[model samples]
Target: MNNLTARMRHGVIGVLSVALFTLMSSTAATATDELFGGLTSPHEIDLLSHPEIKQDIQTWRTDAGTQVLFVHSPGLPMFDLVLKIDAGSVRDGDTPGLSALTVSMLNEGTKDYNTDEIAELFERHGAKFSTRYEADSVSVSLRSLSAAEHRIPLVELFAEVVGKPALGATQLQRLKGEMLNQLNDDNNWMPFFLKNELYAQLFRGHPYAQPSGGTPEGIAAVTREALHRFHSQTYTPQNMVISLIGDLALEEAKAIAETVSQALPEGPAQPPIASTPEAEPEVLHFERSNAQTDVMLAFPSVTLDDPDYVAMEIASILLGNHPNARLTNELRHKRGLTYGVVATFMPFKAGGSLQIKWDVEPRYNEASQALVSEMLETFLRNGPTQEELDLARQLFRSEALNSISVNALAVRKISAIGFNGRPLDYIQRQQEEAFALTPEAVRLAVNRNLDLKKSVFISVGPEVPQEPLPELLLITQADE
Candidate 1:
């Protein structure tokens, strides 16, 4: 840490945090009142004529063993494709920013094309191509015309960027300087302060505890060789999932999948991440130079493989966001302690977390915390009411319907599900399971999955925590 103050960033880096980050860019829908503005209700949509929440996913594998999930839509001549690699920040190991920097450097130049040429190629074909870093994976997504003139050239260019990145010392140093500059400028943009603190304390010793993006020391220490090593080991064909959606035939889709998946060298599969364990109950506070305190209550939730996963999803809906939801009603609607409260589940491969977050004035911070904790306890002890259950079901049904009907949303849905290793019917089953949930089942899930005793409470605001700052954090903040 240098003598200059360390100013934490907020939004941009929020998506890159370690485990339970990304939030899937949120396919989850908001409550009815918020979505429809109360002009119409979610339940008003008739279930009898409602679109089925199903996908005709044509699944296959490339010779290199990359899993492909494809859905054909003949309405438009354009297509959306997504590719996932196991090289998220978790693979950074000792070099925290190694994985993120590696992916960011992908298009700075490739073996056959430079950054300017690559941008020109995409612009020429009217293609939208991007890559994002997640806790468990890195996603490279594209949307372009299906015609060979546009698609063929664009797809090949995509392959070049993914498989043949020109990652060397020059690109490494340039990107490092850019990242450090942003960290220096965005002093007040501490969006993930509470989230970073929460994961640091909650996960403690696990790799999941690592901060996404990277600390100053971590970023400066990242060598060009380390980036190449991380990319090669984790970006292999044996460890990727490809999802394609558009007006193309099965064979055409298969061809596209092949070009992207086989672009990388094969072998050296990613090792499975160890599942997150339950953390003991704890209270933590971050002193932010702000008037209102941002609060987050976190608990270890279900894994993708857990039977209670579906139930946990519904329980989240009932607890927060919805107009009549428990936490919102208690904290904001009835008492007016805050403007909005949100509860979210950040799921990893094996296990994940459920976070209830909100903000309140400094004077009311302690009271808001107690009220939220009490409301959570009562909701767990006594499950959602019949009306609340129906509301959450209707909301889920509406979201599910919209997800499959729209091409843009469906590609993301398919990519997320396939990356997590769920069955083709995972979304469909979740909807069906949510509709059939009895209050008892939801209660069981809330109790079985969330432990009030084990939950960690954290806040960021003007007041410093009673405890002294950790020595590592107290040092002079420098851009190592």
Candidate 2:
């Protein structure tokens, strides 16, 4: 009995020893692998080896107009049309929201269809139509199911909206009243006001400074004659792009495209736009009685055409892009000063702006501005770390891959590529550039673009100091 008991105890001990040994061995192996490889880079990626983008590109020009169709798998029984026009806020003249107003009026009423009939037609076809005005382009889009024969009506409606808008007086008056009410709303934050005011300063005589949605005054000033003239000038087949996607045969799609193109007027005269010029840093300020403080600091940067723009984009991402970005980590996570922050490098036709903006608790308003300013100075003096650049590359690569999967996203990308007058492979080119970015390139971008001293600072909060708000940004004082 004693021998048996001793044997049992020894057997139990042996089992426990083996379990501990296995655990330790597994742990050590994992640690060694992580040491050799990376720990923070969650997924192993080879961005240098470009992924295959299998897109069917079609360029067909009928007697009516040119159509570019990028067809992939018809995953769903739905189709989307991105109707892009060359005219945007850049041609709105002194009327800040004329383009937006014109875009809105299209669906309000048309020649063959009244507003109700148009809405009903879209509803019956199981479709929705929308219009948006960007910096240099305006788009009218339609999304409908293929089973409903949506393409025919969708194209016709688009034609009516673009070619023959019935700018009803009632709709215009209602839209103006709504816009005026919004501008008069005292609860609207003042920093937003300052941002638009900065646009006005930067663009000056350029129409690009006008708000995409015109101000109440601008909307009120728009006459029926002006809408008709603008429509006739801007909405031509020559200056438009019809992007069709989902569940349509190549030939059928081409036929539909031709029909839509033929519906547009020929030889529409393009509106004259002032040449976009370099935007210099300007100091601007506006005060408002809000509990939360908002501050915007903007400086001059590159345009869309510059090769350095890619580097600038990487630098901006490193500055304050994601929720876990450097600025957010330091200011929001560590110091607990502000909850919101963003650093964006925005490029236009001629020049661009690198803007860093933050909203903070009223007490930390001054500290937040000072911290951001100091960080900008430090980043400019010394570029991003190797770790930051790698992270930015990974982030950019991930975003590029994700965007390729969506039809709408692809259309938007193609639109930007079209704006650049580049090949459809611009996204891939951008990805390659991002991945190939060197530390020196990052440093150069920082040095050349970031001007902490020359930023236009606009602080809006209840506790703002009583000071003179300049009409134009004082870049010299900012630089000093």
Candidate 3:
């Protein structure tokens, strides 16, 4: 009996030794593989490493004069269709909110489907349909699975909504009421009031000055007939640019393009927007009993098509693109005068504006303004250093690469290019320019674009120093 027990123990010990040896051998193999897995390959594979992946965009025009831009992304079984019309709020000639209201009313109901039914249809197919109205264009976007069963029906529904929206009186009244309510509510928001007022003062009589949301009086005056007229004039094939991306072949893309183009009436293209005139330098003040004051300094800048646009973009980035920007570094980090400060380049089809905005303690409003002016003046005078230029270029390139890595953002980029009448290779060109940009080029662009002396300064808050109000060209009370 003792001998049997000894044999069993020895057997168990032998089994465990074999098992431990196998585990150690497997771990060593794994480590070795991980250390030199790709040594045999010429290069590693990273889908996002190439910035030129989006360079190949196919372009064609339908028989009805609808321009089509298709980017074939077959890896994903999804698709995005965006139709942009050149009729934006700027086209609302006399009426301010007409274009916005008209675009919003598109999905309310069509001749065949009620609003609920329209919503149900899109939801049933797991699709999303939405609209966006900007200064230069209005867009209707539809994202759906690319299966024929799913895509065909969704596209048809989209065509019906855009091509034959029933501008019902009840719906129009409801939308107008909503707009009026929003406008009334916005009055208490000093930022909104100041922005609109500043635009009115800066652009003056230009259409760019007109509020896209429309004033209360303008929204009240918009008639159903006027909506119908605007729709008839703007929602035409000739004025449309259709952008498609995802698991679609060129043939399928062409068919989809026809589905949209053939539904619309072939009408004349929209008229070109006139150039914005030079803005007069002005200081506008709005008084509000708030803890912190909002200040905005705005100046006329270059349009999207301007030669110095890329340079200005680089310059803007260096100035105040983020928390680490020069403006924020000086105003918030160094001085502790304001919590934050930012600068933005608002580019439109006709022209653009460069604006710097900040919020500061009411007591430091004058000091903040002086510091801001000094910083801008210093930047314009000395320009960026070579190290700063290199950093900005790298930052922009990284952002560009990251932005296009997503499918939806890539489609939006393509749509913007088409809407702005930019070359299909515009992004590539910009990337090249950014990489090759120099400090001198950026300085020249800044000098040619931004004019600090002619900028508009707007302050909205309580205790706004009346003593050093930078050459007040206009002053408005908050209650007004």
Highest-TM-score candidate: 1
lDDT of 2 by residue, 1-480 (tens): 233464689899889966864555443343223322322122555655545333455555667655465453355566677778877877788777788778878888887888888989988887878888876789988877765366776777767776777888888777677666655552263544766776676666677576666677787889888887787778788777777766677776676677777777676535444455556556544555677777777776777878788898888788888766788777666655567578888887666778778877666666666677788777777888888888887777666655643455556666566545666666667877877777877888778766665566666667544332223333221242
Which lDDT tens digits does candidate 1 get at residues 41-140?
Answer: 2355564343344467879989888999988766567899988888887787887777778888988898788888989999999998888876788888
Give TM per candidate. Answer: 0.85, 0.81, 0.85
C-alpha lDDT of all candidate models, in order: 0.76, 0.69, 0.79
| Cα lDDT tens digits for candidate 3, 1-480 | 233464689899889966864555443343223322322121333322324423568899998888899887665578899998988989988889998899899889998998889999999999999998877889899999999999999999999899899988999999998878777767667667777887887788898898778877778889999999999999999897999988887999999999989888568998899999889999866788888888988899999989888888888788877666788777766666566777777888898988888888787777777878898898888899987777677666666654554456667888888877889888768877777778888888899889887889898888644444223223222212
Give candidate 2's TM-score. Answer: 0.81
Please tell me which model should have the higher TM-score, number 1 or number 3.
1
Stretch of 10 with least lDDT, candidate 1: 468-477
Against the correct fold, how does model 3 do in TM-score? Answer: 0.85
Residue 383 in model 1: shift from native, Å?
1.3
